[model samples]
Target: MATSTQSPLAQHWGYYLNGVEQAFNWPKTFILFYSSSTVQKSLFKSLFLNGVVFFGGLLILETFYNGPEHRILGCSYANITGFPMYIALLGINGKFFTPIAEKAFEKQAKAHPRTTPGSTNIVQSMASMIYTTIFYINCGIFAAVLRSLIPHAGPFLSFFMNCAIMAYYAFEYKWLYMGWTLEHRLTYLEEHWAYFLGFGTPITALTFFLTTLHSGAIFGILYPFYVIMATMATPKPATPYGQPLTSGKGTPTDLSAPNKVPIFFGVRKMNDLVISLAKMMGGVQVDSIVAEKQKMMKMD
Candidate 1:
C-alpha cells in the first residue's frame, strides 16, 4: 500500500512492475484478468493461454515416447507419466496465481502511475501483463519441478491427479472465489452452505482416486508440500507481502484474507488428498466394512 520502498521483499518484487516493463523486459509478459470467458482484453496478454493448442498438438504426435531425457530436476518423463494423475495443465492453469499478479499491478500503480487518466490507464494495463507473466513463471517453475518428481509415477495416477488438481483449482477460481468475494458481497456476507461443500469436490475426488490407484506412496511421499501450497493460496487477507519489491523479508502486512480463495485455482497446487488419504491408509475402510460383514455373518 505504501510506495516508499520500505523493505527487501518490496524491493525484490519491483522488477515485475508494468511502467517498469522495459526495465524488466522478461522474454515475454503475460497479461491476465479474472474472467476466463474473455481472451486478452487488457493491454498485456500472456502467451500461456495460447499454449493450449501446442500441448494438444504434442498429445497428437505422442512425443513422450522419444524425447530428450527430460533432465527436469533429474527425473525421466516416463517416471512422471507413470502415474495416471499427473499431467501438466498446459498454460491455462495460470489462474491460481492471479493474486500475485494483482499484487504486482497494485504495487506498480502505487509506484509509477502518473497524474493523468491516459497515463494511469496505460500503466495499469501494462502492469497487469508484466505481473501476470511473473506469477506464471513462478507457478510454472514449481510445477515443472513437481512434474519431474513424478516421472517414475504411473500414467493413470500421474495424469489424473494432475487433471484433478487443475480441475479443482478451476472450481476454486470460477466458483469458490466468486461465491465468497463477489457473491457474498452481493448477498452482503451471507453465503450458501453448498459453497463450503463444493469447496473440496475435486479434492475429494482426487483423494478417492489416489487411494484406489497409488496405494503405497500416496501420503508419505508428496502430501506435505502440497498442503503448504494450499494454505498459502488461501491466505488470510492480512497477508503482508503482496509481491516482494526486493528480495529479503520486508514488513509483514495483513494482506491476505482469512477466507481467501483456495489456490487449487493456481497451477501450483498438486492436490488436497493428503489428510483423507492418510485416514484411509490408517484403515478406516476396514473398520466400516467390518460392521457390514458382521451383519451379513449374523444372518448366515
Candidate 2:
C-alpha cells in the first residue's frame, strides 16, 4: 500500500514546535545572555551613569519648575521620561552592551575555532551597519514626503511607518549577534516570512499604542522591560546558505580561505531591485520633463 504525503502544514510542524520550545526557554536564555561575568564592570559603570543622568534631570525638573504638572514647562512629564529612557538605553547599548557582546563572541570563536576561517561575519557586520543606516535615512525621508502628500492620513501613515521601523529594531540586534549577513538575513526572512511577521507585528503595535497613554511617564519607565523581553525572544539564526557551485558530484564547495563571499556581501537582490528602479526613473529627462509640464500649464 502506498502512503499518503503529509500536508505542508504538517510537514512544517517542526518550525512551530521549535518556536514553542524557544518560548518556554526564553527566561533562561535571557538570564544567560545578561549574566556573563565578564560584562559586570562595564555594565555597572553604564548603569551608574544612566541612573545619574535620568534621575538627576527628573529631580531638577521637579524642583525648579512652577508645579509638578508643568515640570518641564511646555514639555509633558512623559516627554522627560521617554527621552531619558532613549538616552539610557542607547548609551548603555553603545558604550557597553555591544563591546561585551563582541567580546563574548570572540571568546566563543577562540574556544571552538572554525575549521575554515571565514570573513563572512566581518563583511556581514559592515554590510548590516551600512544597510541599517541607509534604511533609516530612506525611511525618514519617505515618511516626511509621504506625510506631506497625505496630511489627512497622517495618523495611519505614521503608525504604519513606525511599525516597520520598530520591527527592524526588534530583530536587527539578533541578526547582528548571529553574524548573519544581509543576504542570509533576507533569505531567512523570505523563508520564514509568516513567522517573522507574526513575531514582530504585535510588538510594533503594542509599542506604538503605549506612547499614546496619558500616564506615559509610568509606561515609559516600563517600556524597556518589554524591549528586553523582545530581544530575548528573538530566535536563533537559520543555517547559512552554502556556496552555489560544487567542486565534485553533490559535494558542496568551500571558499572560506579566500573569503570570496565578501565580494557579494549584503542583499544583492535588494541592490538589483534598487538599480532597476533607478534605471527606470533615470530614463526620464528631468529638464525636458519640467519644460513639457510648464508648456502644458501655459497652454491650459
Candidate 3:
C-alpha cells in the first residue's frame, strides 16, 4: 500500500475515507465484543452500571421534575446534571473501561506485536491516568468556550475540535498500550488531523445535538464499541502525502505535510496551566512522572 503511485491528494482523501470506514465497522466491533469474555464482561458492566443505573436514574428524575410547575427548576437541573454525571462516570467506569481497553490491545498485539510495548508500575500508571483525565476535562471546557465565544463559526469550529478530541479518546488506549507518551499521542493526532476528523465524525454527530445529560448517556453506551474499532483501525497519516512545492525559479522549496493542524494547542496550554497550578499547591507533579516514563521508554 505504501508503494502505491497515487497522487498526494488522492492518498489524503483515501486516508479520510479509511477513517469513515473504520467508524462504521460494526461487524468487527460485534465480533470482538462477543469473542472475548473479558470484553463482554466489561461492556455488560458499562451498560448495566452507566446505562441502566445512572442514565435510568436521570430519566426518572426528569420524568418527575419535567412538568410545567417545576419547569424552571427542571431546566436548570438539566443544564447542570451532565457535568456532575460526567465526573461521576469517570470515577465509576474507569476500571471497567480499562479492562475493555486491555482486551482490545491484547487482541491487536496477537495479530501484530509491538516492538516497544509500554510498561509502567502501578504508581506511574495511576499518575498518568489522573493527568489524562484532568487534561480531558480541560479540553471539554476549551471546546465549550470556543462554542460560546464565537458567533456563527464558533459551533462549527467547536464541532471539528470535538471530532479530533473524540478520535484521540478512542485511540488513546491503544497508544498507551504501545507505550506512547501523552505528548507523542497528541502530536501524532494533530499531525493526522484529517483522518481523525473523519474517524470521530460519527460519534460527535450522534451526541452533538442532544442535551448534555442525554449526550453523556448516549456516549457512555456507545464509547466501548468505538474503542474496539479504534484498536482494530490502522490510521494512514498524511505524512506520506507531503508533496514539495516548487519555487518560480523551479527549485523545490516546501516539503511539509498539508494535514498538520494544531487542534489541541489551546487545550494543551490550558491543561499545562492547570497542572502547574496544582503542583504549586503541592499536588502531584504529572510532568515529572511523564518525563520519567519517557526516559524509561527511551532506555527500553
Q: Which candidate tops lDDT?
A: 3
TM-score of each: 0.22, 0.45, 0.81
Between prediction 2 and prediction 3, the one with superior TM-score is 3
Check candidate 2 and list the clashing pairs.
none
Write down the lDDT that model 3 would get: 0.76
**Worst 10-residue stretch by lDDT in candidate 3?**
291-300
> Model 3 off-target regions past 4 Å?
1-10, 68-84, 114-116, 120-130, 242-257, 276-300
The runs of at least 3 residues in candidate 1 whose Cα sits more than 4 Å from the true structure, single-residue gaps closed, are 1-56, 63-124, 143-300
How displaced is residue 215 in candidate 1, in Å? 23
CA displacement after TM-score superposition, residue 122 of candidate 2 (Å): 6.1
Give one digit per residue, the lDDT tens place, for model 1 in 1-300: 342334433332332121122212222222222332232331122222222333333343345553555535664453454332323422233443344333333433344453111211222233333333433444444444554565665443334334333323332322222223222221211121123223223344345344322321232122222222222222112223343343335744433223233332333222112223434676534444334323322311
Report how far off residue 58 is in candidate 2 (Å): 6.8
Q: For each candidate, what is the lDDT?
A: 0.32, 0.44, 0.76
Residue-wise C-alpha lDDT for candidate 2, range 182-274, written one tens digit per residue = 445445554543334334445445555543332223223323333343345544323223313334354423322211112112223334444
Per the 3 Å backbone cut-off, how many clashing residue pairs does candidate 3 have?
Answer: 0
Q: Residues 140-252, candidate 3: write the lDDT tens digits.
A: 99989989999999999999888998899899878777777677888788777778988999999998878777888888888888999998888886676544433344443
Model 2: weakest 10-residue lDDT segment is: 256-265
TM-score between candidate 3 and the true structure: 0.81
